[model samples]
Target chain A: MKKALSVIMVVVVMFLASFTVVRSASAEEVKITGVITKIEMAADKKSAIAVLKDNKSGESVTITITDDLTLDKFKDHRIVDGDEIRTKFEKEGDKNISKMFKKTAGC
Target chain B: MSGKIITIMLGCALLTTTVQAKEHPGKEQILKDGYQGPKTCEVCHPGKAKEFLGTVHWKHASKADHVDNLNHKEEHGMKNRIYTMCNGNDIVNNLKEIPPNAAGKTKFSGCNTCHPGDHTIDVGSTGPEAEQSIDCLICHSTKYDFRKRKIVKDDKGNVVMTQDRSTEAAANIGRPSIKNCMVCHEAAGGGALVKRGFSMTKEADVHVSKGIICVDCHQAKNHKIPTGRDPNNWASDGIYMTCVGECHSEKPHKDAGINKHTAKIACQTCHIPRTGGAFSKDFTKWEKMSNGFYEPSTLKREVNETAPVYAWYNLTVSNTPHFIGPKGSRTDGKSKIYPFKLFQGKAYYNKKDGQLLSMDFAPPMATGDTLAGVASAAKILGIKDYEPVPGWQTIYFGSNHQVAPKGKALGCANCHSVNGVLNLKELGYSAKEVEKLTTPEIYFEKLLKLQQENE
Candidate 1:
């Protein structure tokens, strides 16, 4: 009976810890503007990554995009290499995630 | 005390320069570590200076002159280059009017690249002393080591004039050596395979191995490299020109029968047969670096090699045989048969408008942002809707540079056999012609053996 009770308590504590991780991973948005140097699809098929180089600084950063609703649409115009783009993304834990991408190239 | 000392010091410096140039007259100057301006060398070599300035190299400073006698494709190439530097309306319009090359006008007279002038300075406007303009050591000095700095101008800073030669430049000036020519010629148009399909820098270039230098055949006159096409192509006529006739009799072949083909074929056709021994590679994806340079996305150089395509050439005017155009092209009864190299590359172009989108698409040889280049091109062309039609493009250019020894020339099977590099049918040969070309020759002895067996 004691072992069974300890098991239940441990399960409850594990469930509580997962919520704590979610709560602490407060999603914050960051906007970056640069040229899309390259785009790569995820090997596990869950997301895509776009590498952008800051034109002014020559520095680069990669953003992981997982929004299923926007993935195909995002690729149509904004994801092509050399497209000068402005993107709004969020960082939850370690991943730089993208929510919006705009190709601001002149028509 | 201060003014007088400054004046005296300046006088001594001028005296030192004059003494140094006089000491090495007809040789390279011993500058700080760079070439002294061409003016300094002309003090000793006025004739050479006058001659070199007349060459096409100096005229490139003006875009119009570059395409003056070139074919349609070359004119297109110049349009592409201007697209790279044009950003605004005034600039585009100004560039569209290909102006006359006021030799002493542009900031960097094309001559500055090889002659030793500060590319950063607008010597045309700055009116810097003539002594500050020309550096003759670059082409004449065997030990000359000079690199031109990029034209750098920032929003906040006023443009800076390119400084003079390195104070520590060692000097050994003399007539141009092969090494001196290679400094610029090797990288002409960009890399080893640019401009012409091959370069003299390669060890495989037969003439380079034969102890031949650029001047051997070029034989400069008023700095104009003679084309064997000159009406007065007299080899012994004080013009250091060379043609196959120089070494070969009317028939260069050991077998006179084989030499008959010379009338319809260029010597390079059989001799070169291949390049990089016939191979090349180009990685497709590349990224633009922060400093406005392009690099392969995967950080690897692409390698792709293929067989050469053949063509007809007439040397007097154009290197490319305008008559035939391509390997599969038929001669329009204008050009004689010539050997050529067909180089291929992948890039984007606007299919709708038959123009090469120089700014928007990465050229086959470019490593920078293709889209950015295209966009800029679109801006200049004033196109509202621009899209890319990505594909590989090929050009038939001269194959005269990289030559193999006679022994390595292609055997008959390389072209005449069924399994050959070229498809005669594609080249517009009839079925009968193809069959006849593919048939193996039977010597008289072999024919006699077959007759005996039948008997």
Candidate 2:
């Protein structure tokens, strides 16, 4: 019984250390400004994939937006093709998940 | 009572200025250290400096994919291209010196006066040194005095123009507004209301009356402002700003009959019936000089409130230096009827190779030797030989701004009549189609009869 308790304590510490590493990895956020070249809404209308052409580098970046506000904008056509947008996103696995998706404010 | 009120007003103004200064603590350090140029700003906003360096404004060149005559592999822009405004002169060279005979405020400074660089000589250089050459205050500071820019000798003894570097302007910084953009745009093609003919008065544009601004439509990302296929400046990535999907619905008109025209007619066609501001340059005829060079004749026509000529544009722009216009036809499926301000001028072209000669008529306009100018231009372009001849040309400036109110748009009778503004034959329509388009009375009568029968 004493041996089993010691093993359980070791497992709990390992699990907490792994959780801390994951938290640190997800903390890095990137911001970009670009024009939306294309948008693909999910069949369920809960998420979307937006391809933006970076204003400076002229490189294309794909970001997934699952926020309710941005999803409603896509449905109403307020944020459509050719509209310039400024966004903040974080890398999760192989995909970029949008943290903040908004049109580039002007004037 | 008046004396007390004056004191109170002064106190309030000072307090407001102090509060504004406190809001931007980073700028306060600039005031403390004095204006040390772009390097100071780069310390805090390094990302902005890097991003701005890659912009078209900094490089003065980009890929001209929107140009119909250009191959996709080549890169071109305002710096390298010979355009209508100063066609015969070398633009890169002209950035250094304002010709002795330059007109108006340009006499004091060269093209570099409007450029957002510390010195004319450092306009297109790269790396950390080039990053330091950017004059951030000119666009960002409201207090930056435009009059302070003057022609001065650089450390290398090169004649270059420089701008104000006062700590006051450095302390006050913000995003660019319409006022900042107008300082240069209003002065294009020499002086106010000369080139584009855009006016910011409420009467000029309904959008302005409703508190809209230039940047609202010309949205920018990392300083890359998307543009229409203006031959003077083409989009590198073929990205263009559109009104249909952006600010308005694809079909905005309430009437189906009117909405049907949206397929082939652009909004500017009926919306902007007239363009050009007060004293806009309409035509410039260059006459042959005794010295074998051509100079602009005194007989120039300036028009105001001019009617725009209609044309079919399909997003592709002509790259020809002599005559840059939109390339499209009524038969093309993507073509749409658009409005254009046709500016007529005269210049010399090569009779042998059919190349337009860059007329060297900058300073000493009286002795503009066409042959010498041609040789200089040819050397820069790597051309071997040419036979120069005088010729006429026209540049089409798209009518995209100074939009009128919805009610002020063109009426049906404006273009659907025998003596209307639109010329059906010139628009590349079939003879039968022309007759049908010009005779709208028949359609009106048929509609009236149908309505009477229903009643």
On lDDT, the candidate that comes out on top is: 2
Among all candidates shown, the one with the greatest TM-score: 2
RMSD of candidate 2 to true structure, Å: 27.0
Q: After aligning candidate 2 to the native by TM-score, how far in Å is the CA of B57 from where it should be?
A: 1.5
CAPRI quality band, candidate 2: incorrect
Q: Model 2, B13-40: lDDT tens per residue?
A: 4543454455456766887788788777
Instruction: Tell me the tens digit of each residue's lDDT in model 1 across B1-455.
Output: 23543454455445434543554543333353344455555565565654544344432222122122344333222222321111111212211111122231222112123323433332222233433444554555544333332233445443332332443332565446565565555433223333343445335566656555666556566655554322111111123333453344556665665577677666767776664321222223455434344433321111113356655444432222112123223455444455554444444556776444444332311334456645655776787765766554444445555667666677566667788765678666899988888765623454466579989
For model 1, the chain A TM-score is: 0.61
All candidates: interface RMSD:
16.4, 18.2
Q: What local lDDT score does residue B377 receive in model 2, on the 0 to 100 scale?
A: 60
Question: How far is each candidate from the true structure, as Cα RMSD in Å?
Answer: 19.5, 27.0
**Which DockQ value does candidate 2 get?**
0.01
Error of 1 at B231 (Å): 21
Report per-candidate DockQ: 0.03, 0.01
